[model samples]
Target: MIRPKWTPVAWLADRMAVLVLGLIAGFLVGLSFAGDGRILPAATTVASTDGPAPSPVPPAPPVAAQGVDGPIPPQVTARMRRGGVLRVGVFGDSFGNGIWDALYRQLPTSDGYEVLKFAKEATGFTRYRTLDLEKRAYEQLARDPVDAVVISFGANDAQAVYDDGHLYPLMGDGWKRVIGQRVDRFVAAARSTGAVVYWVGLPVIRDPQLDADMQAMDGFYEAHMRRLGVPFVDSRPLTLGADGKYTAYLPDSKTGRPVLMRTGDGLHMIGIGYQRLTSGVAADLRRYAARVRQAAGRPAPTPTGEPR
Candidate 1:
């Protein structure tokens, strides 16, 4: 058999055919992988020590719910009545500022709510020597009577406490009792002024160890708040992913858009995160106020003044 003349034109034609076939094969392979739910590896940048590191993966969306339960006392209802000046005193560490600021901004203008901020950074129930929150609360209460009190501590409480020159490890036996006593005293002092108490729980932290510590602290708050009949607002479910781990970002509860919720430090919250948290708190407060009105045999007044 005589081979075809190996001319330049023929050689070029063969090469083009091979290239076309290779292209088709590559396209089909990519399509097959796509059908199998496979995707091209995304490019990631290595973080430098000079600046903050970015999140490795996008966080899952937050679940919808608030952490409020039980009935609102009649007295609390009366105090939180609509159209009255709802004197609210907020006390806690830096975390409290996020929620308090959001709450203050979102408070209903018609409700006539007055918020007094008393959040001191790096302060907690355990830091008695450094800052006595219980004493500060008492003094503030005595000076100005508040109708409701909002408290959010525990971020700074996950450390050793010094008592009589002896230091106790955080979450230890002695630490638990001392912190519990302080919390009890603070709650009692707020209640003495006929103010309803709302204790916000710590949210999930970015660091694994810190998240674990926060979870433990939340348990303490839950138990104590339950015993005292104060509303305990657990923020874990809101800030946690479906895997029950801490997430830096969560979807906007209203808009369904992804929003960076936590800060780079992983301990504090950004504005969007704080807004999401306080929105739930405000909603729960409104519900409690409505329940109070109902329990008092006074139906909620219609906005239009028409009988429902």
Candidate 2:
């Protein structure tokens, strides 16, 4: 066969390009598939702690006082008064990457709240059922009595399977039921520690189907948390783009551009991505912190204690 003069070079280049593309595609697939095959191990740390424990029941703070008008919300006011050591249990899989670390750095040095994390991406409620990392954290926090506990881990669970090994239905079905069960267990575990529960909703995903599943889970948890009187933070609105999907692979809020939320593999967020996410979370925490102060009638100080 007569070959063109550039055929050899072109063929080599083509092969190399295919090889690179294949590797990249494989990585993306791996990231999406990570933890899908393995059921998150059940959490087994539910053993109750001993001795006199602080009040686990988050009491309604005094109603905004008799006539004092504060910028803080009622919940914030209540939280401020009860403030002591805030032991936060950040729970989830890779979704939690940079979550705790970022929050740790952003926390106010003067807030006096001690934060603790119990997050591990790829692990879900199914894992918690047996392993119960949150329960362990609760017991740990109870040793010193943490004022609040923040739970964030829905990216994996939104499309995850239950203990029975059934994939949650495409719409609403056994999957929702199992997910609800998982959430219930998680809430109960965290609340049992007497720490006020703060559940974070799933943020938007790039994929449409995943985004829908995430919203469904978020809605279910939001309603459940409200009904149970637990505090729930919805992160979707903050992360969604004009198309109404997760826009940041790595986000640049200032420029409104997708910087790099996920790693090159698309499973984890890079440092910058985590930083941005934590910024949003920190803002929410600041808002909640203000609420705690107002509710508790405590004086407001800078969250970072030195001008944002």
The best candidate by lDDT is 1
- CA lDDT, candidate 1, residue 212: 82
Model 2 scores a TM of 0.57
lDDT of 1 by residue, 33-75 (tens): 1001111100222123432332343322332221234545545
Candidate 1 scores a C-alpha RMSD against the true structure in Å of: 21.2
Assess the local accuracy of residue 182 in candidate 1 as a C-alpha lDDT between 0 and 100.
82
Highest TM-score, which number? 1
Candidate 1 least-lDDT 10 residues = 33-42
lDDT tens digits by residue: candidate 2, 157-205: 5433434323333234444555555566666666554445556555555
RMSD, one per candidate, in order: 21.2, 14.2
Q: Supply candidate 2's per-residue lDDT for 277.
A: 49
User: Which portions of model 2 miss their true places by more than 4 Å?
Assistant: 1-85, 128-130, 133-138, 158-172, 243-246, 249-258, 271-308
TM-score of each: 0.68, 0.57
Give the Cα error of residue 263 in candidate 2, in Å. 2.7
